[model samples]
Each structure stands twice: as structure tokens, then as C-alpha cells.
Target chain A: MSEVLTYITEHAVQWGAVILLMLGLYIVMTRGNLIKKVIGLNIFQTAVFLLYISIGYVLDGAAPIVLEGAERYSNPLPHVLILTAIVVSVATTSLALALIVRIQEAYGSIEEDEILEHGET
Target chain B: MERLHVIVLVILLIALAVTLVRLRSLLAIAILTGVYSLIMAVVYTLLDAVDVAFTEAVVGAGITLTLMLAAISLTTRRETKPGKRKGQRIVGAATAIVAGVALIYATTDMPGLGIQDAPIHRHVAPYYIETGPTETGVPNIVTASLASYRGFDTLGEVTVIFTAGISVMALLWRWGKDDR
Candidate 1:
């Protein structure tokens, strides 16, 4: 019990993030709804963002602002990387949504199974 | 105290994710996704990635949500029932579990939270920290590195975003012939 507690205390955030990633994947894999799948993708992407930023954390560190006297700053590289990632994600989401709109217009349904059934018929 | 806060937020995020999965209403899902993004932005802020948090807030919560809602308005709001057979679901679950376990196992090799000597920190990070302000004359190291040290990468990212915008417009733009 004590060991379990120690592990949880040590790695709770990371484990939480990992669980979120799994949940996102589960949704993406199981859901027939295209929109839900997109939401899952967003969740998965954000989980990765969480993991990257968390790795850059420094104990007792201030934000990565350059100051004359401040000594410790959290690693800014991951933050920079994630900034670009966020914009890319938004672009992807918009493109995906636009595609979904077109899909709906073309197939009259956004559910994967429905679209497939229509194709079969 | 901070760890506790992070843990709490993580739990909340999990709860939101579960709810998002269970809910079948697309409108509700869209709103929940926005809320999830907002919470993620807060989490990023707590992790001292303020710039990331800002972008997540704008893109994740703001623009993405609006676009999703627009798409939802154009499509049906109710998701059909799970269409996959039991075997498919089982396979998917197995794959997700294997991947998750692999990722967790991989984390064992990673340096613990905030070790100053972590490999990631030992690399170009130190150089950026030491020279970023002087070289770029920017107080924010992230700004300096993103705009100066990695200018080409930023330019490429901008180009990608612009291409996406143009593609979306081209895909959606219809001639006025239908109305006429």
C-alpha cells in the first residue's frame, strides 16, 4: 500500500495524462461518429501537449521570462514546440471539420457505418 | 500543494473525457470539447507553458469549437449507435491497452519531474537560456527561440496554416450559380 501511494504521488500527473491518451484512442477506435472521432483526436493531441510541457517543468522555477536575478526557469523549448503544435492542431481541426461538412453533403450522414452502408447499397 | 492541484486538474480532465465519450449529442459534445480545451489551457498555464496555454485557449477552445459547431449545424446532431461488432471493439481495446502500457513502460526511462540534468535540458535548452535574451533581445526565451533561433521552422508552420486556410476555402467555396 505504501509503495502504491509512493508511486502515485511520484507519477500521478503523467499516469493521468496517459490514461487520457488511452481514453482518446478508445473513443476514436470505437465511435462511429466522425465528429466524435475528431473530438477524440483533439483530446489525444492535448494529452501529448500535456506530457511534453510536464517534462519541461523545473522545481521552484518561474515562467520562462528572462529576468536579471532569477536563476531557474522552466525549459522553454517544449513550450515553443507546443505553441506551433497548437496552431497546427487548429488548422487540422478546421480542415477536418470542413471535410466533415463535405462528407455530410456528399453522403447525407456523418456516421461511418451509415456512409459505408450507403456505399454498399 | 502544486502537485495536488495538478492531480486534481488531471482527475477533472479524465472525468470530462469519460463524459465526452458517453454523451451521444453532438452539440453537447462540441461544448464539452471546448470546456476540455479550456481546462487544458489552464493545465498548460500551471505547467508554466503560458504561450502554449494562450494558443490552446484561442485555437482549441475558440476557433476549433466554432468550426466544429458550424460543421455540426450542417450535419446531424445525434451519433448512431456503436456499429462495430464485439470482436472489433475487443481488438481496438486490446490495441489501445497495449499502446498505453507501452507508453507507460517507456516513461520509466524518462528523467523524473524537473531534474535539472535531464537530457532535454542539457541539450540546446541551456544555450537558448544563456544566449536567447542577448542574441534576440527578447525577454521571453520562448519568443526568442521561436522567432529567432527557429525562424525557418516558424515560417514553415505559418505556411502550413496558410495552406490549410486556402485549402478549406477552395473546398468550401461554391460559385454563385446555385443562388442565381
Candidate 2:
């Protein structure tokens, strides 16, 4: 039992990220709201970031910096990639929102079904 | 870096993600997403990725929330209940669950959390950690790697952001009359 708990503890971050990713998938698949879809995408993106950071963790390691007395550091490559990805995520979110605004302006309704119905006419 | 703390934070992140899915009001979702990202930032810090934590806190929490709220202001504030979407919901849930279980199963092959000599810590990482500061004069290894070693990646990142900016402006800016 204790071993099982330890296993759970060790894998918690990875499994938690998977769950969050699934939730994002569900949201994107089911929600008709475009903004909600974007939020769902954010959740998915954040989960990827979480998984990457978790993978880069080193036991008792210092943050990825050059220090005189530090033994080791967590992998810096993931940190670099994620830093760039996070900024890109914000950019993608803003651009998606901009398109949503245009959709609202053009169709006079943001609901997907309504927009489609208008299109049929 | 108490392991317990990480477990707690991961649980909190899951709870927050679940809450976000349940929310109907876009405004409330926007605010809660900020809170969620802030907590996620704390989790990143505990995992020894300070640069990532800082970026997540700032861009994920601050800038993303602002853009979400701005978009909400321009569009509807509340999500209209999607009509006859029951079949879609069931299919989505099924797919998500199946994929999630598969992903968790795949985790068995992953190195356990925080093993010092994990494969990821080998190869280029050791080279970067050992020689980055001396070569680039940047104390932060992440910065050195991003700005110096992986110059093309940073360049591509800039291009993505620039394209996104121009596209957003083109979509939202009023060029002629009858613009909303």
C-alpha cells in the first residue's frame, strides 16, 4: 500500500497533466463558444508546459543558472523552449480572440449553431 | 521542494481546470483562468524552473487574462447553451477519457520524477550547463540557451509573434466605414 502511494506521488504531476489535457479536449470538442474553445486551448497548452517542466525536474537540483557552488540544475532546455512557447501562446490567444470579434461583428451572433444557420440562408 | 507540496499543487491545478470547464460566464472564466495560471506558476517554481514560472505567471496570467476579457467585452458575456449537443458531449467525453487513459499508461515508460541522472539531464544539457556561461556570459542557462545556442528557435518565435500581431491588427482594425 505504501509503495502504491509512493508511485502515485511520484507520477502525480504527469498524470495530473494528462487529466488537464483531457479536459481541454473535452471543452474544445463540445463547447460551441469560440472563446471557450480558446480557453480550452490554453488549458491544453498549459498542460503541455506542465509536463515538460515535470520531465525536466532534477532531484535536489538548483534552478537552471550558473552558480559557483551549485551541484546541478534542472534541464534548462525545456525551460528555454517553454519560455518561448508561453509568449507564443499569448499571441495565439489574442489572434484567435481577434478573429472571434470579427465573427461576432459579421454574423451578429457568436454562437456556432446560429452562425451556421445564418449561413444556410 | 517537498514532494507533498508538488502533489498538493497538482491537485489544485486539476481542481481549477475542472472548475473552468463548469463555468458558464465568460467573465468569471477569465478571472479564474488567471488564478489557475498563477498557481501553475508556483508549481513551476517548485520544480526548479524559475524562468518558466516567471513567464507563465506574467504571460499566462496577466496578458492572457487581459486579452480574454477584452474579447469578452466585444463579444457575448455568457455562453449560450449549445442546442442538442448531447451526442457531441458524450462523444467528446468518451474520446477524452480514452486518450487520457492511454497517455497515463504511456507514462510508465517515463523516468520517475526528479531522478538526478535521467536521460534528459545527459547529452546537450550537460554541455550547455558546463560551457554556456563561459561562452555567452549569461548567468541564466535558459537565457543563454534560448538567445545563444538556439538562435533559430528564438528567431522563429519572433516571427510567430510578429505574424500574430499583424494578423490581429488586420482583423480588428477598422479600415473603412461600417466597421464594428
Writing each residue's lDDT as its tens digit, candidate 2 over B22-96 gives 999999999999999999999999999999999989888999999999999999999987788899999999999
Q: Interface-residue RMSD per candidate? A: 1.1, 0.8
What DockQ does model 1 achieve? 0.79
Candidate 2 chain B, poorest ten consecutive residues by summed lDDT: B171-180
Q: Which sections of candidate 1 miss by over 4 Å? A: A1-7
For model 2 the local lDDT of residue A109 reads 83
Q: Could you tell me the TM-score of candidate 2? A: 0.97
Query: What is the C-alpha lDDT profile of model 2 across A15-92, one tens digit per residue?
Result: 999999999999999999899999999999999999999999998899998778999889998898889989999989
lDDT at B165 for candidate 1?
Answer: 96
Checking candidate 1 for backbone clashes, the offending pairs are: none
Candidate 1 structure quality by residue, lDDT tens digits, A7-40: 6655777888898999999889988889999999
**Collision pairs in model 2:** none
B-chain TM-score, candidate 1: 0.94
Best by TM-score: 2
